[model samples]
Every structure is written in structure tokens, then in C-alpha cells.
Target: MKSEYILKTEEDTKNMAKEIAFDIKNKIIFLNGEIGAGKTTFTKYLVEAFGLKDEVCSPTFALENRYETENGLIIHFDLYRLKSEEELDMIGFYDTLKENATILIEWADKFNIEKYIKKYNIISFKIEDNNIRAVTIK
Candidate 1:
């Protein structure tokens, strides 16, 4: 079941993330958006909604950030700096998928989307206007 939502500001984006968080269960979510878009902001709210107390930030430099929540672990990945899919293997990407965790990936376009199609709920974010964003889920 796919869905679409419109967010007018950062707050709206966060709220939308919270709503989506409730429906997720051991799933993967791919967040696609441009720089300065609300991907990280949405992720922060999603983590919070999962009852995580730690701060949520972009993993651009760190590559990935893992948070342990009451439900399970949440793995956030930023592929902006990744040179190739081969690097994912070196970093134990497949190992992460072995766990019953929720994964949210940013800059997912850099990777092969088909690899995760069966296990992921894809969310694509697009700027509709200066203060508005359209998020589509499939």
C-alpha cells in the first residue's frame, strides 16, 4: 500500500515521519531528497517516535549511525560520499540487514534500489516550493 503526503515546513515533515513510524515494523525506508531537504529532520522525528532518546543527525561524515531503541535498532545510512556499492560490502552493510532492525537510508539513489525493493518501503522527497515538500511512499 503506497501513500503520499505534503509537508509545508520542518514541523510538518516531522509529524509525517511520526505517523509513518507507527506503521513500520522491521522494515527499511529509503529517503531520497536534495541537500537542505528535510530528510534528517524527518529521521529525527521517526527515531523519537520509536522511543529513542539519543540525538539523530546526518551520517554523511560517519557514513552510518546506529541507535538502539526499545523496539529494536535503527540504522541510518548516508551514501552521499560512498564511492561505490563495493564499499557497502566492506562496511558490513549486509550484516546490518541480518538483524531485525529498522533501516532508514538517505541518498539512496546512489545505490541500487532494486536490491532492497522487496524489503523496503521507499520514500521519495521532493521540494514543492520554498516551504513545501511532497513525500511519496511506495
Candidate 2:
């Protein structure tokens, strides 16, 4: 499935995230975009919709973060700083998918995830203007 939305403001982005949170099935999510394209921001709202009280921050340096939600665990990974695909192996990337959790990966381009992407949703963020974003899903 593919969908596109124009977010003129942060609120629009939030609304889109909320809708996706409830609509998207439990599967891996690959977020693709530039550094400031709001990939992390979109995941933040999705986590919020899952009943997380604390703020959601990117796992840039940490590599990953986990949020326990009523539905299940939400595993968010940022491979932006990953130097090689071997790092994913060291970090137990496949083990993560084996678990019963919703996985979302930012900077997924670091490695070839095509084999694991069949059941996943891909969301690409593009900055149209300041605070304006073009969000597309595939």
C-alpha cells in the first residue's frame, strides 16, 4: 500500500502519525529521508500514540531504543552512524525481527534490507519548505 500526505505544519504531521499508528499493521518499518526530513519526528508521534508518556528521541548515538506499549514493544533503530552492515550483525539485527515487536528503522539505507522488507512499510519524508513536509508511504 502507498499513501502520500502534505504536512503544512507540525500538527498535520502528528495527525498523520496518529492515523498510521492505528492503521498500520505490526511489521517492520523503514524510514528513509535526509538528515532533517522528520523521520525521527514521525516515529515520535507513532510512539506517543502507543501510550508512551515520555518523549521519544532518536537513537542516533545509542543505536536503538525500545518502548513498551499496550500493543507490544516498539523497537526504534537509527543506523545513521553505522559504518558497515557487519555492525548490524554485531547488534543482532535479525534477532530483533524475531521478537514480537513493531520495528522502525531510520537510515535503513546503511544496509540492504530488501530481504526483510517484504512485510514492512516504507515511509519517506521530504522537506518541502521550512516546517512543511511531504510524507509518502509504500
Candidate 2 per-residue C-alpha lDDT over 1-138 given as tens digits, one digit per residue, 9 for 90 to 100: 339999887788788888888666467889999998888888888888888766889999999999998766889999998988788889998788777788899988778876765587889998875668888998
Give the clash total for candidate 1.
0
TM value for model 1 = 0.91
lDDT of 1 by residue, 60-120 (tens): 9998999888867889999899888899889887677677878888887887855745777
Which lDDT values do the candidates have, in the order given?
A: 0.82, 0.83
Error of 2 at 5 (Å): 0.6
* Consecutive 10-residue window with the lowest summed lDDT within model 1: 113-122
The local lDDT score (0 to 100) that residue 79 gets in candidate 1 is 86
Q: What is the lDDT, from 0 to 100, of the residue 125 in candidate 1?
A: 81
With a 3 Å backbone cut-off (N, CA, C), the pairs that clash in candidate 1 are none
